[model samples]
Target: MKRYLLSLRLFWTTALSAQLEYRFNFLIELIAMLGTLLGSVFILSLFFSHGNKIGDWTWEAALVVQGVYTLLDGITNTFLKPNLSEIVNYVREGTLDFVLLKPIDSQFWLSTRTISPSGLPEICLGFSLIIWSSNRVSNGIHFDHIAIFIISLFCAIIILYSFWFLIASTTIWFVKTWNATEVLRAVLASGRYPVAAYPPSLRLFFTLVLPVAFLTTVPAQMILGNINLLKLFTSLLFSIIFFNLSRYFWKFALRFYTSASS
Candidate 1:
């Protein structure tokens, strides 16, 4: 465990150093992130412009959902996209052999080999929005609520990573899964709005099928002091299931791997 921790530090430090070399890119990313966030808020405002509440969610509450989505999206950009997207290329080019040969776990090495600071601003802004909006709706943040929110948010992140890795693992059989990843992204985009805002059919689909509700809405609700133990338990259960499924799928896929030398 200590060795792995040391390795993680080295991996991120190296990645951060490399990213810093192109410092101007950070400014570009920050500007783009701000523009996107503002545009999202503008569109959200249009829904409540005429005193229309989305489902039972007030504007502030809805912003909490958006904040959670943004936070997850930032994580995707920072970690999942940079690392998981390379799985397909590694498979196609036979580079995965090198990865598998490493003393560390291949999944660990692949998933945490690099860090992108471009999404750091988005992450910071997401947390700020979540706190600001959540406080407006409920009494100022409670320690208990914050603790529960952190737990739910951690589950959400695990679920998100599992979904991505599940898709990425298919590279063992299908060398190009880019379209699948895009479809997942499109589906996940719906998470920016409260799940209740969706039609019944879509809401059920998002909750049971894709589990998008757990990704954003549930966490938002938790932070807003609407803590539902059942929902939180469900989220925790789903995260564990998804994560294990992804891990198992990767091992299964590796059984079929044929190195370039072969």
Candidate 2:
């Protein structure tokens, strides 16, 4: 465990140095990220202005959902996406062999090799929105509600990580997992709205199957003090199941990874 922690520190140190060396490019990327986020919120507001509420959710609730979604998305993009994305290239170019040769956990190393400090701005913006929205509520939020929101947020991240890991592991067979990642992104983006806004089938899929409901809606609901113990347990179960499945798939993929140069 200590050795793994050391490797993670080394990895971050190298990544930070590399990012510093390209500070100008990093700044440009950060600007682009902020633009995209603002653009998304603007579009949503425009749509909401056309109609009072989308389904049963008010504009304020929608904004809260968007804020939470953005924060979680920032976290994923900052850490997991930047690193897990390289899995396809590693498998295709035989670089994975070098990773495997290391005495540490290959999955851990592969998943943490890169970090995006540029994502901090988006995370900050999202957090600000969340706080602002919480204060905007007519009735104030309680400590217990805040605790549940935090727990739900943590569980949401785990669900997202497991889902992405499962999709990225497909690279071992598909060799072109980029499209898969795109599909996952599109599907996960739907979590920005209340799942109740979707059709029955879609809601069921998000809640029980893909489990994107736990990503943003559940956390938002927790803040609203609408969460039930049963649902929380269900989310926990889904996280554990998906995480184990992803780990198993990654191991299974290893057996089939014939280095590209081999």
Candidate 3:
């Protein structure tokens, strides 16, 4: 375990060094992202100006939902998305063989080999918005609420990772799954809004089918003191099931890997 951790630290340091080699490009990308985020906020403000509250959630509540979603999205984009998106390329180009030959767990190595420091801006922006929204809300934040929120948020992160792993593992069958990651992004993007804002059928689908509700909405609700015990338990149960299923799928996919150019 210590060796694995040490390897991960070394890998991260290498990735950081590589990124720093082209620091100007990273800054440009960060600026572009900031602009895009500002545009999104402007659009949301205009929509809320129409005074339409979707379901029981007000615009303020929607802001909270988006804040949590953005924070989690930043975490994934920083740590996992870059590597997972390239897994198909690694498999097709035979680079994955190098990873497989390593003594460490290939999945761990592949998933954590890269990190995007640019994502830190989005994470900071999201937390700022979360704090601002909490202050605006009538129910004051309490220590217990914050603790539950942190716990639920961690579970949500696990759910997101497992779900993405399931999609990335499909590369073994498809051999070119770049489009699959895009599809996964589209599906997860919907979680930026409160699940209650959707139709009943869509809500059910998000909660049970894709489980995006547990990823952002449920955790945000827990912090807001609006989460139910039943929902919390359900989220916990789904997290466990999805994680185990993802592991099984990854193992199954590995069994079929013949390696490129073999």
Candidate 4:
């Protein structure tokens, strides 16, 4: 674990240096990320302009969900999304063999090799939103709720990475799995709002089948003191299941990878 951490730090240090060399592109990407984060907030604000609240959430609670989505989305951009896209490119270009031969874990290398240092600005932006939203709530933040929210957020991240892994791993079977990632991005947009904001059928589909409810909804709800035990347990259960299944599927997928043989 220590070695992996050290290697990861070294990798990021190198990646950061590389991005710094491309100052023009780096700045453009940073500005783009900033615009995207603020755009989500703008949309949320527009929604609240029409009414006092969204579903069971007050405007403040809805903002919290937006903040959570922004944070998680930054994380996904920094880690899973880029890696999955790179993996697809590797498959298409017949370069995946190089990754398999690397000294580090293939998953770790694939995940961290392409760090988006530009997304750091967006992550800070998201953290600011969460703090700003927290201040607006009348109910004082509870230490216990904070703890639970942290745990829920952790599980949410796991579920998200697992979902991405499932899509990326499909390349072992279907070399052209670019459409899968596109579909995932479209599906994940639903998490930007309160799941209840959608109809009962859509909400049930997200909550039970897709698990997006756990990603942006449950964590913000937990922080708002609105999380039920059942929801907490459900998120935890699905996260564990998805996390394990993704890892297992990765291994399964590797069996079909002909690599250089192909």
Candidate 5:
């Protein structure tokens, strides 16, 4: 474990050095991201100006949900978005053969192929929002709630990564599978708010079929003391099942591969 972590650190160092070569571009991108975040905060402010509660969530709770959404966004940008997109290109150009020949786990290599340090500011902003909201909550938060929220959020991240991987791996069989990732981005957008805010049918769809419930709502609700044991267990169950399924499916996809040289 230590050796793997050391090697991973080395990979991060190399990636960071490469990205720093374009320091001006990196700064510009960072500024643009900050502007987008401010816009999102402004919209949320208008939302809360109308009412204290939206579907049993107080304004602070809602803010926490938005923070979770930000964290999810940062995660997608930092890892999944760039690498998963490349996975499709690898398939289309038949360059995945180069990835397969690497000595390490291909998925791990693929996942860490690029790192977006710019996303770290967004992640920090997300945590800062959570802390601000928790401080303002009338009932106050307990350590247990925070602990559960951490676990639940980790599960949500795993579930989301697996779901995206499931979609991306389809490229092994269907070369055009890359475009489907845009649809995934749309679906995950629904997770920006509490799932309960949607109509009953949409709520059921997000909760059961797509996992937006586990992705955003459950973690925020857990932090706010609004979640139950069943919700926690179900989130864990979904994450474990999907993570295993994506792993196995990745192996399944490899069976269909043919080299670019062919």
Candidate 6:
């Protein structure tokens, strides 16, 4: 564990150094992120223009959901995209062989090999939105609620990473799974709004099939002090199950891996 931590530090330090060389990109990313956030909020406001609450969620409460989604999106840009998206390139170029031959765990190496600091602004803005909007809500924010939100958000991240890695792992067999990942991202975009805002059928599908509810809604609900123990337990259970599935799936995929020599 100590060795792994040391390696992670080394990996990220190198990645950060490289990213710093392109510091100007940070301003571009920040502007784009702000525009996206404003657009999302604008679209959401269209729903409440006539004083219509979406699935009974008020504007402030719904903003919490948007905040959660933004936070997750920032995480994807920072970690998941930079890391997992390269799996196809690794497989196609037979570089995964080098990854597997390393002294460290391949999954960890692949997932934590780089950092994208451009997403840092989005992550900060996400927390700011959550805090700002939650203060205007009826329940408001409390220390306990913040604690629960942290735990819920952590579980959400696990579920998301597992889902992404699960899809990316398929590159072992399908070396060009870019479209598959894109489809997954499209489905995940639904998470930017509260799941309850959807129709019953879509809500059921997102909850049971894609589990988008756990990704954003559950965490937002926790922050809003609508603590549902059952849903929390379910979220935790799903995170564990999904993470294990990703781990084991990667191992299974490796069984068919053939290096460049082969």
lDDT score for residue 80 of model 5: 78
- Deviation of model 2 at 167, angstroms: 1.1
List model 3 lDDT by residue over 1-262, tens digit each.
8888888889889988897788798778778778766765776577567756768877777777888887887787788787888788888888888988988777788788888765666687778877678657745788887888787888888899898989999998898887878888899999888999899999999988999999889988887888688888888888898888988988899999889986
Name the top lDDT candidate.
1
Q: Model 4, residue 247: what's the lDDT?
A: 78
Estimate the TM-score for candidate 6.
Answer: 0.92
lDDT of 4 at 168: 89
Show pairs that collide, candidate 2.
none
Where is model 2 more than 4 Å wrong at Cα? 47-51
Model 6, 114-141: lDDT tens digits are: 9876566568767998998888884457
Span of 10 residues, lowest total lDDT, candidate 4: 117-126
| Candidate 2 lDDT by residue in tens digits, 151-174 | 888889889998998899989888
| Deviation from truth (RMSD, Å), model 6 | 2.2
Residue ranges of candidate 1 with Cα displaced over 4 Å: 23-51
Candidates in descending lDDT order = 1, 6, 5, 2, 3, 4
In candidate 5, the residue pairs with backbone N, CA or C atoms under 3 Å apart (3 or more residues apart, or in different chains) clash, namely none
What's the lDDT for all of these models?
0.89, 0.83, 0.82, 0.82, 0.84, 0.87
Model 4 lDDT per residue over 1-262, tens place: 9988888899878877888998898888878877876776688678668757778787777888888888888888787676668887777777878888877777777767767754565577767877678767845778888889898999999999888888888988788888888899889988988898999999999988899999999999888777688888888888999988987888788888887455
- Candidate 2 matches the true fold with a TM-score of 0.93
- For model 3, what is the C-alpha lDDT against the true structure? 0.82
Candidate 6 Cα misplacement greater than 4 A, ranges: 22-51
TM-score of each: 0.93, 0.93, 0.93, 0.92, 0.93, 0.92
- Model 1 deviation from native, Cα RMSD in Å: 1.9
lDDT of 6 at 160: 93
